[model samples]
Target chain A: MTKVVLLGPQRHVPTVRSALDDLGVDGPVAVVTAGWEEREREVGELSEHLGCETRNLKLFSRSEKALDKDPELLDALRALNDRMRTLQEHYRLRLAHTMGAVRELVARRGAQEGALLEEEIEHALGAVHVLDQHHTRRTADALGTFDERYKPTERESIGRARGKVKRDLSPCAALLVAGGHVAVLATRLRLFVIDQLIEERPVVAWSAGAMAVTDQIVLFHDSPPQGRGFAEVLTDGMGLCPHLVALPHARHRLLLDDPSRVSVMARRFQPASCLALDERSRATWDGKRWTLGAGTRWLGPDGTLHEEAVPA
Target chain B: MSLAIHEFLANGTPTPEQIDAFLADRTIPIVEGPEVTFLYRGEAAEVSLQHWIYGLESSREFTRVEGTDLWWIVAEIPPKSRVEYKLGVIHADGRRELVRDALNDQLAHDPFGSNSVAAGEGYERPDWTLPDDDARPGTLEQRRIQSEALGQRREITVYLPARYRRSRRYPLLVVHDGPDYLVFSSLKTVLDNLIHRLEIPPMIVALTASNDRLHEYADDERHGRFIAEELVPAMEQRYPLVGRPDARCLMGASFGAVASLSTAWRHPGVFGRLLLQSGSFAFTDIGSSNPRGPLFEPVVRFMNAFREAPGKPAEKLFISCGTYESLIYENRSLVPRLQEAGMTVRYVEARDGHNWENWRDRLRAGLSWLFPGPLWMVYE
Candidate 1:
């Protein structure tokens, strides 16, 4: 049986524990986050509160210095910078000579000093013009060099992080919970684990995480006076369990004011089922049917439930 | 090749034909000057030199034996075409000196304080010293054990004011993009300097690392919960945290900026001060669809919710962005929206781009404005 649980935003650890216990899934869920250490520890405690196991699986960490400072890839960047400098110097000399001749002719003819001054001025101006053009071309070449160095290093980093998660997958039922930006990465990670490791793990996500498992992502950024909320159309999703669109924080007044907008969005996107879970609510998917659990209410268009048939 | 030509021209003496051959071969025409003029493709152009000297003086005398009138040389060249040549000057001592163009912008200052025509500005390389294993606040043994609980042991560097340990209690600031703040912005060093000068109040800064920074800094519950539930408790345990709403501040840039604001907006009791730089207040598609009640609308609603419910207004809110940043327009619009909602807002527009350079430059100003120092003293 497949089970889907929608937990509320900022729900107490006891509520999360009760939901997991009722599902009969055991301890030590793999926790993937990009939060600070103290935050990660609190998450660990939450797992402890629920009598479950927890593991950290984080991908990219921020660095204050340049990306090239990482010991693993610093030398290559330094070499590239060195080469870029050499090319620029070579061009500077070429431009100086091209402008020097004009400076001389104006001086030799016993001409007016004004005419000679203008010629010297033209020579200086010409030299600067050529140098600017050459500098722009060389800078583009330098950027390309940096890109060539970064690609492989990023892949290796992702591979090592994924390897740790795969090693932690247990023999029992597997449950994955992802939230916020982890949702987008989690979907990709889930696909990688399923495709390469040949594992069957049930996964769930909240907020951005939930949006990642669906067929598409609808961004809410409004530019300008309203906060920036731009909608995105995604082609790839985890597709672990098909046909349902999971909406977390459904009860957030900002999201739940009008059911018509959701229905219109649903129709335009065309998912088989639309499940809106508010804080402290659960929408369980047991393979065949999705049961909307207690905590919050889900209202469809026309002020009624949108389900084909309400689950017990 | 061009420099080689200039050096050849600078050689003390050359026959007129040698000079002519050089000019003609390069498709450059020579015009006698005082004022030499020409038309290139029908447009007139002119060139003139203010000074010119020819012929060397006697070996014992350091003077020009043959000098032309200062206005003697001038010529015309086509607009936008480049021309290069060198000057041959006979000094009073009968020696020649060749002067290259000194107007080159690419000239870099050398270590010995001389100017050199280098490709780019020669800068001293950054001496980046990784924190010593023991230099970190806690013990290495404890860090390793804590690392196991942390799952992935990414480095987290904290910033304490110079008088932090001596201070009875300090205000706390929880910020996202920890690594970037510490290293890129030199946040700790800035704080240290500021505190030493007594320019700003001594504060305990908890720089939290955001692994999946974008997702974690979204207007979602996970990020809010992480701060309110996990981050706060952990920091409070180790540090002498004031443990009051007004003393606690939250801050971040871009998406992290909005997350900080949202966290404080949602739970003003938990976070009272906000330093939002280039905040992403726009709506995103990942969360709920509340068309009538969009995220920004709710922020207004939340403000109203706070007002109608009657509570202390936020202690301080510092919002800022660079003038040239892409988010400038959006951020400008948000200021009035926040002000109208009754937030105690101090807005600043920086002249920069949307990167750490700008953020670092403004961190000191933002901090000082939010927490001003003692009244009487001025340090030079």
Candidate 2:
């Protein structure tokens, strides 16, 4: 049973120190900032903030170098990425129509249209849910196929990197993951099997880091440059917390004020509670249950943020 | 509303001490609703307001206080309008000179000089255009490429976004008159902020300059060939750019805008997006004498030719022009023509002049619409 702590973006306010104090575990911590990409090793500020000895695993560079040395495996991964992108595009197309119908029906909820409207709304919402599941499965299958064909863990360069990561993690009592490009962070984490190494250890992550530790990654934004902000399922995460849909920068990215959008999102994900992980938000998991911080909020089916954490 | 200025005026001519008290801790160009009053406290024979707002008097004499050295001019500037102006001071020595408002610190700079900026009511300089400590700055590398079409070595600055990697292929945006835009419009900072905010994707920006822009950027075939044939291909060979036309954008303002439009027109389906600002698209309704002068003859010719056929130059175009600019008519007229040609066009008009800041202000809307980043679309 791993003691997992999920945090919001560490910009204005940071709860990592308090979270660490509550965990009762101190000393050397393994830090994975693979999402930071080129700035992966720049942890001077983070080290000072933690007030503990921090060891950077440098997973980003290791994975990049490994992929560089193994072109065949790199090509295979790129192909998988391309396939995932196409699948996501297709998912978005289907999602748009279904979501439009849901919004239309939701807007007409008070009308005298009766069960037919409610039934249509449910059908539309179900279609969206089915689309999400289909996309998730397709993404899983794509990754599964690539893994089966390439056996990335067994690859010579990847194996070497993993062996080094294990040695680096041996002296650490806890693992801290910082947010950045979530895709890069997740891929690098998977490549070196850092998830497997920190099975029972205390882990604290924030933003994209929090999203990466969840069972599924759902990308959401209310207003983007391109068009409407549709929350689309990106892919599976490390499965550290299977019941959480971590939404970092939710206040900035999401239209929480609009009940229709919020309700649609809340009801779409169903069992997995859509957590609004703002800068002050924090949630701690002790295997059996979650103890949410005061600032932690979850999207409710009524289209508002609730103080209490919805039980997984 | 600046109450001090109003109080000072209400109490008749102010003494030196009173004027100093009014000036203390006051931001210049006192904006009160639709009325903007520009103040200059100095000893001059005459002070007049020199502004570039279209449909308004080009120069208006400022009223000098009888007992004080203060000179003030009030202009009815609409809400959310950004106006740039200078003070023309006629010294007692009989020499006249145009200078920026000494009392006002807010200034907008161009190639020639800087002018004091007077933002009307409900207007604020966008925070994203300014530099942020959190936004990672991109690296700019200068590369000189020999252009066979122009027969000159051109210096093109390439901007690689922060954390740019070889594994990822980025969209390309080719800009004309790059150096001027950097110095005047703060393009680098704008790119950094937009990318950091995820409004626009991390992209490879090709900043190209020309020696003879007046001639070269005036729909010259050689310049078009240089951009489409030489510069783009050279950039593609060196950097990992998405080869598709949609991913490639051509951008410019004024004559540079003309160059961008003509280049895309010459090489249809080569570049997908066009960001044209205050384009010098002078054209004639019928066969007549060119009233815009000899320099615009070539531009008028190009515009005429383009308007005739008006084939799809790019899939989408972001056209912006200042309402105060003389080229507003031409920019506005070109939009319908571009749309008629079956191209997706986004036309934006701002109460600005034909200067770099107006172009700068429109960058976020244009670039984001053209190449939106993963901030909203992609999770990474």
How would you class the docking of model 2?
Answer: acceptable
Alpha-carbon local distance difference test for all models: 0.49, 0.88
The ten-residue window of minimal lDDT in model 2 chain B covers: B371-380
User: Using DockQ as the measure, which candidate wins?
Assistant: 2
Candidate 1 local lDDT, A178-247, one digit each (tens)? 4544323533343234334325455544544455455443333111111112122322344555665555
Q: TM-score of the candidate numbered 1?
A: 0.33
Per-candidate DockQ vs. reference: 0.01, 0.27
For model 2, how does the per-residue alpha-carbon lDDT over B1-380 read when each residue is reduced to its tens digit?
A: 55546667897878899888777757788888898888988889999999998788899999998888988887889998889999999999999999998989899999888999999899888888899987999999999999899988988999999989886788999999998889899999999999988888889999998878999999999999999999899999999888899999999999999999999999998999999999999999999468889888899999999999989999999999999988899999999998988999999999889999999999999999888776843232
Reference A-B contact fraction recovered by candidate 2: 0.33
Candidate 1 C-alpha lDDT tens digits along B1-380:
23323343366554555544554453212222221221111111211221111121211111121221111122332232122222334544556544332322222221122221211112222221223221223211111113322344444455665424532577888888866776666666666655543446667887776676655565555667667766677677777888888788888987778678767665667887889897755532344343534435533343344333424336678888866465776677766666776667888875444555457667766777777642111110
For model 2, the superposed segments whose C-alpha errors exceed 4 Å read A9-205, A226-239, A250-282, A292-312, B1-8, B43-46, B90-95, B165-168, B377-380
